[model samples]
Target: MLDRLDKEFAFGREALDVRAYRQELLSSNIANADTPGYKARDVEFSSALAGALKQNGTASNSSTLKMAQPVSLSTSSSLAVTSQGHMSGTSTLAASGGSTDDYGKLAYRVPSQPSLDGNTVDLDAERVQFADNALHFEAGMTVLSSQIKSMLSAITSNS
Candidate 1:
């Protein structure tokens, strides 16, 4: 049913959302590189993706069991701030095969060269990282779109 589709696409959807968030954060950092006390922030890409995967797995498993009021798969991870001011968050998923723990959730890269005013935005590095994140975001979108198209085609053919 529609619920299954939503669960199946949940991982990709979350990835796209996180990617957009990262892009925005990176853009803000680049725009305020010269601003004092502006700490550059970004989510840990690998962990976020892993968390999404875990959530999907958990949801699917819960669905099969017919549990009354299945646990929400959108639980947010704990935030961890490193000594250098980087923040990390974790997301977990429960699955039939096994549970997945997504370490390194949301984290900001500590600036290699901290400004005297405590600013951590490195113009060059932020720009490069932003571009890379954008590329991955676009790729994720493409994959999701293709999957949707394939599913629609399959449904239409059957009808």
Candidate 2:
């Protein structure tokens, strides 16, 4: 029953998480606009959400027991560790600063107008992205809330 609930909401859950993470990235870019060579960073939302869905097994093979199980990246053999002492990819990203370890796929934003300080962050672009992402995040929250409310109403009616 719990797994069913998880699988049902996994997509929306992951979508919200990615949106929030993107918000952070955009905010960071805007905040560091004056920093030299900061290089604006932002995540590709569709790709990130798709990857998360695959990890959650919600995008494919939903009937399998693996659905809703978190994938262990440490066990992935494709990852090449330069040194035994080196931290995992997620931890490394978190340690570097802003972005979380989840969906460690931030892309550098291309600047429309080059800056003398070498900073790629465009204030106008960042502001627009931030607002758009925030709106999406709020919409996701509302949808999730509505789904839960509907479920509760159904359960209560049956009781």
Please, what are the lDDT tens digits per residue for candidate 2 over residues 1-159?
A: 877777667677778778877887898999999999899999999988877667656688565223323323343234457998976553222222112445657899889999998999999999999999999999999999999999889888955
lDDT of 1 by residue, 1-159 (tens): 756776667667667755766676788889998898988888787776666555545434454211223234545777667677765656653332212233235566787987899898889999899889989989998999999999889889955
Candidate number achieving the greatest TM-score relative to the actual structure = 2
Q: What is the lDDT of residue 92 in candidate 1?
A: 55
Error of 1 at 14 (Å): 1.1
The lDDT of model 2 is: 0.76
Off by over 4 Å in 1: 52-60, 63-106
Candidate 2 to native Cα RMSD, angstroms: 7.8
Each candidate's clash count: 4, 0
Tell me the deviation in Å of residue 152 in model 2.
0.3
lDDT of all predictions, in order shown? 0.68, 0.76
